[model samples]
Target: MRFGILVNEGPFNHQASDSAYKFTEAVLRKGHEVYRVFFYYDGVNNANKLSEPPSDDRHIVKRWSELAKAHNLDLVVCVAAALRRGMKDELLAEGFRISGLGQLIEAGIQSDRLVMFGD
Candidate 1:
C-alpha cells in the first residue's frame, strides 16, 4: 500500500513529528510505500535546515532529511505555513521542498491511504 503522511506540529514541542516519522519508517519496513509527507503549520519546522537540536538529542530535521534520502521520499513543507513559521526556500532541508497544498491533495488522491499526525 502507498501511504500519505501529514504532520501539523513542530519538532520538540510535541511528539507528533516523531510519531509520524516512526510510522513512516514502520510502513516502509513492512514493504509498504510512502507516497509523500506533507508538513503544515509548525510541522514545517521539520524541514528547516537551520534547526540545531542538541548533540545528545534527536535531530528531527536531519532525521527527516535522511529518511527522505534513504527511501527517496517526497518531503514537502507547505509554502504558506512554512513562510509563516519563518522557513524559507534557502533554508529547506536537503530532501525537503516548499510546495502548495495542492501537493498534499495530490498525495491523498494518489496514495492508498492518507494518515495525519498532529497535536
Candidate 2:
C-alpha cells in the first residue's frame, strides 16, 4: 500500500518527531511504499536545515534528511502551518513561494492512505 505520513510536533520539545522517524523506518522495512511525509506546526522544525542537535543527542534533522534521501521519499511541510509556526526556509522567507498544501494534495490524492502521526 502507498502511505503518506503527517507530523505536527517539534523535534526536541516532544517525542512526536522521533516517533515518526521510527515509524517511517518500520514502514519502509515492511516493503510498503511511502508517498510523502508532511511536517506541519512545530513539526516543520524537523525540516529546518539549520537544526543541529548535540553530539550526544539524536540529530533529528540530519536523520530525517538522510532517510528521505536514501529512500527517495517525498518530504513535505505544510505552508500555512509552517509559516504560522515560523519555520521558514530560504525559498519560503525570500518570497513566500508555493510548495505546501499543493504538494500535500498531490500526495494525498496519489496515496492509498494518508497517515497522521503526532501529539
Best by TM-score: 1
Prediction-by-prediction clash tally: 0, 0
**C-alpha lDDT values of all predictions:** 0.94, 0.77
User: Candidate 1, which segments miss by more than 4 Å at Cα?
Assistant: none
lDDT digits (tens) for residues 1-119 of candidate 1: 99999999999999999999999999999999999999998999888788898899999999999999999999999999988878999999899999999999999999999999995
Best by lDDT: 1
Predicted candidate 2 versus true structure: per-residue lDDT over 6-99, tens digit per residue: 8879788888888889988999999999988887777777877676677998988888878877898777778788778776667332112225
